[model samples]
Target: MKAIFLVPKDYKLTGGMYMPINHYVDYFNRNGMIVDEIIELPYHKDNTCKGISERLHSKLSEEKYNIVGFTLNICYMMLRDFQLHKNSNCDCTCFLVDSMSLNMDSVIRNESIGKEYIEHILKFFLYELKEKYCLRNCNKIVYVSSVDKQYVLKRFNRDILGDVFVVPNGIDLPNEVSDKLVRNENDIPTLGTLTGFSQETLNNNLYPFLYSIFPQIIKEFPDIRFVIAGRGASVEVEEKLSHLDNVDYIGEVEDLHDFYDKVDIVVTTVKKDCGLINRVLEAWAYRRLNIGFSKNFAAFEYAENGVHYLSADNEGEFVSAVEYAIKYPDKARIIRDNGYDLVKNKYSWGKSGEVFLDIIENK
Candidate 1:
């Protein structure tokens, strides 16, 4: 079988969005199928509907693929204008990393009502309509997590004629486990988190943990440190972190492994219940103790509260979880080992590829 993937022009090889497409291409080619990727024109204010339709039509006509896949960001507007799924001969599939409606909802509920808030409300309605059109017309819909799939289904409420499949995000394991998991005699016990510096994450995840939760943790363990790393931060966030004594804010990391190695415990501060929790998976893959909010863990139904990793729902629980990790190092090692085993067994790129291939071929 032959397949083609349409991705946004700005898509990078790293990060959550590109992982599935990268693995799918490798998996299909290794299994004697031809797979290719096309970088679509960047969407901008100047691009017209006619131009998008013409470009997409020309591209589709150039190949005779059995499956044509589209990343949701690049194709949502195109799908609305061209109805490419109805016009094309091959099976059209829409790949969603997360539900845009849910993301916009998070911004509305959390962010202050201003220009950005009003803008998100407008986008919420736009995405709701376009997503409905794509889900109804496409032959198949692929979601990165069950949480996203169920949210879309419940939000739309209309009968979707297409087949829906959940293909969870996968990670690439390191060749050798780093020795950083073993703490030094004089090193400070540190807790770390990595996330994008978007306004939504800053308000919902980072600020809450830093302002509300971290102060309490500091009161209990005055010597402990916190490390933060991600893409970018606003001036206000940077100033706040600068004032904090032991909090080290590394602006952006070149490699995530280096960041994981520096911290003793990984805390995922995301409270939103949508999208795959990549930080939890990365901590597990690196063989480090992970503590995350109970709500965010809903993204991974297979992960248990006490078995796979520690769960904290409130400030008090989070403080206690950190305290437990510090006081009982041996027990924390056991939990980390369990988490490592879970990632090795279930969350590999090869495994995710096989499931995606099965959906494409058998479904």
Candidate 2:
């Protein structure tokens, strides 16, 4: 079967949306399906609509695909384009990687500083409305995590939501990278976190929270230094975080396993998400104990609360979890073993391939 996957834009080696494309393309291609990931859509840096509609419409004519899927982002043009194809009786499946609703919050974030700049996005509600209407009309909608599924379900009834499917993102066991987890007597314990600076967190709302939380974590375990790995830092975020004692900003890593290898613990501090995150799965593959907020269900699904991962509902709880993690070394070991077992048994990419094929065939 020929399957075409639509992403918000092309893969940039960094960003939250790239994970599903990377994971899915490998799985589908290996199983005798043509998986085409369309990454040409523009973003803030390149804000040109520039014939994207014609390009996607032309792609459909090039080949007869049995299924077409979408990877949702802050923008819904990718989602709407897929619906246009599906409406033409072109068999399709959509992966709403984020919430089902229009991204008003993201629209606000992508807004520019100038008077006419932000005004354009602010006045484009009808375009967002069109996207929302198209999503409601699509044949099948796949969610990256159960949290996403529930949020969409709660907001819009099944009557409005068509064939809704919830399949959490899967992880490969990382057999090849297993040998690379070499521990060195490094300068610090290497507590690490990854994600581009999403505009949501780039604001001043989160830095004070980090300041309050990190200092307490250090007092409990002085040997550990934090690595904020990713390309999301703005001039403000960089200035605030870079000079701080041991917080290292390793911008846009080529191989994430290298970052994971040096870390004693992986942290996911995402404040919101309905989908499963790729960060937790990477940690699970390396047998690193994950500690982070409970709101991110992707991590919550793989790393059981207090079992395969440590969870914190609040700032105080996060500090306490870290303290307990350092004091009890066995805790990390046990969680690591359990995390790998869970990934191997339930969340492998091979399993994803088999299930996805079934979805296309059955639909």
Candidate 3:
């Protein structure tokens, strides 16, 4: 079988989206399928729908591929292009890596943003409509997490549920988990997060909450330190966090494992219901105890509320969880061990490859 995968134009191979999609391509090829990846679609960053429409129609009209897969970002054009190739013998699948509906709902719920926010709602509504159409029409709908799959089922008609499938994101495990549970003979605990600095990241209200909650944590455990690392941190964000003595910002990092190795605990403060946060897997791989909201762990199968990692939903709970980890060293070590075992057995790239092969084969 021959297949083609469509990714958004200017899609950087850097973020969480790259690894999962790359795994899909490799899995298909290993199963005797010839897969061609096309990242030349002209819609995402460019709003010229008509030109993109014409080009996609022309491309699909020329040949019949056995399977045409679309990365979720370009779902708006998937169905329209597939319509042109309807005469050809091919199957269509959509891999929804992110939730457009949830994201739009997030923006719409905050009515204080004014007129432009309404425009964003209408625009996102069109994208949601297109996504629903593709989900209804496609041969298979692959979701990155079961949480998102359930979210779609609740929002859309019940009939499409059967077509939906879950193929969780995979990670490359580190060779060895850090054994340095204590901070250099001082025993001062350090917690950090490596996150992108964007409006979406800010919208989660995570960093700001941490900024507020950190002072509280340090009041009891005075030696604790919090490190924030990522790109796009505006001056405003930096100023807000600058007053705290225990807080530090390292900006963007080239070696994430080195960052992971240095920290005693990994903190994920995502406030939204979305795909599996990649940080959770990385934390487990590094044998670091992760403390964050339960929603961030919704994308994985092995994470139990108290088993794999410490769970916190709100600001108060998060502070308490960290305090508990700092006060009770034995419990923290247990969490780290459990998380390492879970990631080792179930979350590797090879295991994800087997899952994808079964998905494409209709198993």
Q: Pick the candidate with the highest lDDT.
A: 1
Give the lDDT of residue 128 in candidate 2. Answer: 40
Task: Estimate the Cα RMSD of every predicted model relative to the unseen true structure.
Answer: 2.7, 5.5, 3.1
Tell me how many clashing residue pairs each candidate has.
Answer: 0, 4, 0
lDDT of each: 0.76, 0.62, 0.71
Tens-digit lDDT track for model 2 on 49-86? 43655555676666666544455432355444434545
TM-score of 1: 0.90
Ranking by lDDT: 1, 3, 2
Give the residue spans of candidate 2 off by over 4 A. Answer: 12-19, 29-32, 35-64, 72-89, 100-131, 158-161, 175-189, 204-209, 232-239, 298-303
Residue 284's C-alpha lDDT in candidate 2? Answer: 79
lDDT of 3: 0.71
lDDT of 1 by residue, 221-313 (tens): 888889998877888878888898679998788987778878888888786666888888888888888897886778777788877789987
Quote each prediction's TM-score. 0.90, 0.76, 0.87
Error of 1 at 153 (Å): 2.4
